[model samples]
Target: MLKTAGDRPYRGRLAPTPTGRLHLGHAATFLRAQERCQAADGTLIFRNEDLDPQRCRPEYAQDALDDLRWLGLRWSEGPDCGGPCGPYNQSERQPYYLEAWAKLRDAGVIYPCTRSRRELRERVAAPHEEDEEAEPLYPPEWRPAPGTGQDAQEPGEVNWRFRVPDGERISFEDELAGKQSFTAGQNFGDFLIWRRDGVPAYELSVVVDDLAMAITEVVRGADLIKSTARQLLIYRVLGAELTPRFAHCPLIRDEQGKRLAKRSDALSLRTLRERGLSPRQVQDMAR
Candidate 1:
């Protein structure tokens, strides 16, 4: 039986993508995670979301650890300090991801996607009520018949997607954001779970890792509110008796009123520290 959140102690995580230096937006969101976890007297884990080999670098990962530490964030478990969930780095957790893929395959909820990236771009984009960065929905007419992927022993041969029930409304209550809702196939279509390049996609990996780690609450930026709706489907398909509660913190924006990105080096924690800013000063700036 999948572990239920009610039976476990409160557990939260700091999942940082090691694609670039940690920025003020990351600092604000992570600090909120620390505050919430401490309020519940819960354990906090540091997970290195370094699944993209081409983009992720060891130096960047090390920099994240250093920057967060310098910002006064502490965790009970992480890549640096061993814990029950040992391979805290996503790259090292492939076997776990593969297992979840197989279960999805067996359940007939996932299918191989032969569509290439270029072809998808040239086609009509999916109807979306989100930001331009949202992925174009997979054309429902292109789907292979149900059970088309059951013969594949390994998922790396082709990309795999979790088929969402079209037009069905997926909803969840966030501890911070409050009531939220989105319609499947409209907001998002069959989402990628495994890429043809042999990488587990973010939506799948986070769900598997969060459940495996027994996390009770997830704290992240508000931009991912739609992602939470998608993840709720995965939890349901995986037979999770109870899913983690979530807190989507507000994003830190730049002078132009655009949300901060990792490319904002001047506002990065490392850069701020280099400017002789103390941890307290940095925290205040993030606020």
Candidate 2:
């Protein structure tokens, strides 16, 4: 059986990206997180994932807090309401991510990639437009020899990818999804931990933050199941004693059967509020 933080007092979190307004889907997922935390009589921390320098906006961040509050959800710790686990915002927690990068670097499990997107697409079997969210598998042939990145002092100036142990199966029992498994290189190849723009990627940042906040369970949309597999590797590489369990709620889709995104403004929590939808009504719609 996998060791988990189940024995610890439940520490759940609602980590919302501030690239856009929270949509109905986001609200539903966060509500699930809050519900699970409350069911366990746990502490709920709100993390603002506003690391995207190009897309994240102060207005969007504020709007996420406002919209979630309007939806009648409350968090004990967050960017607004300070708590012991602050600074709750990802933007303020770069030092923590950088520290993790250094640890991974020192462990010699990560390497620098200087290849551009065009170079990758031309070289590797890139995913098509339908799979835009999916990254092309980093070609194993292109990897520098082991110990190539040992001399680098910092992760800036190039993309850094964690070398996945190919052909190894990564399996975990999700509390909600149940009996999940994925192959390493086939499911995903070496993945980005730090981008060339000096920003820590999602895979690395979330793991570091969860460990730091002592998050006992990760509650998020089911769309992130593959991401969970990737993060599990990070946890092991970082020598995390007890990794959080997962509860993946089903994704909310639009009328077209497409998963809701930040672009789904009509179903955004802010728009729903302006349309006079009550908290109960929105919650019902989410259900």
Maximum-lDDT candidate = 2
State candidate 2's TM-score.
Answer: 0.97
Which predicted model would earn the best TM-score?
2
Position 57, candidate 1: lDDT: 96
- Write one digit per residue (lDDT tens) for candidate 2, span 214-249: 999999988789998899999998999899999899
Positional deviation of 265 in candidate 1, in angstroms? 0.6
- Cα error, residue 8 of model 1, in Å, equals 3.6
Instruction: Please identify model 2 stretches exceeding 4 Å from their true place.
Output: 128-131
lDDT of each: 0.89, 0.90
Model 2 clash count equals 0
Q: Which stretches of candidate 1 lie over 4 Å from their true place?
A: 1-7, 126-132
